[model samples]
Target: MNKRTNYKQEKRMKELEKQKKKEAKKERKLNKERMETDGGEIAGQEEMA
Candidate 1:
């Protein structure tokens, strides 16, 4: 029974980790897109100045 509980806990922890990683990846992708768009505008303004 103890070993089974431990196995379940480990499985749960792994699932949580996977979810965290997926969220982090999605956030990074959004940030990268935001930066690209914002950075392009800033660079264009600088060039004009």
Candidate 2:
């Protein structure tokens, strides 16, 4: 019983992590586009980070 619960919890954690990564990627892409539209300096700062 405990083992099953642990497995489910781990799976849930992994899914959450994956979702967060996807959202972050989308945000970065949007930021990059916005930066390009504005100026190259912001994009360069993103690369540095």
Best by TM-score: 1
Runs off by more than 4 Å, candidate 2: 1-5, 40-49
Instruction: Report the lDDT tens digits of candidate 1 across residue range 1-49.
Output: 3546588888999999999999999999999999999999999999999
Model 2 over residues 9-44: C-alpha lDDT tens digits? 889999999999999999999999987877887777
User: Candidate 1, clashing residue pairs?
Assistant: none
Best by lDDT: 1
Segments of candidate 1 deviating more than 4 angstroms: 1-5, 47-49
Compute each candidate's TM-score over C-alphas.
0.76, 0.69
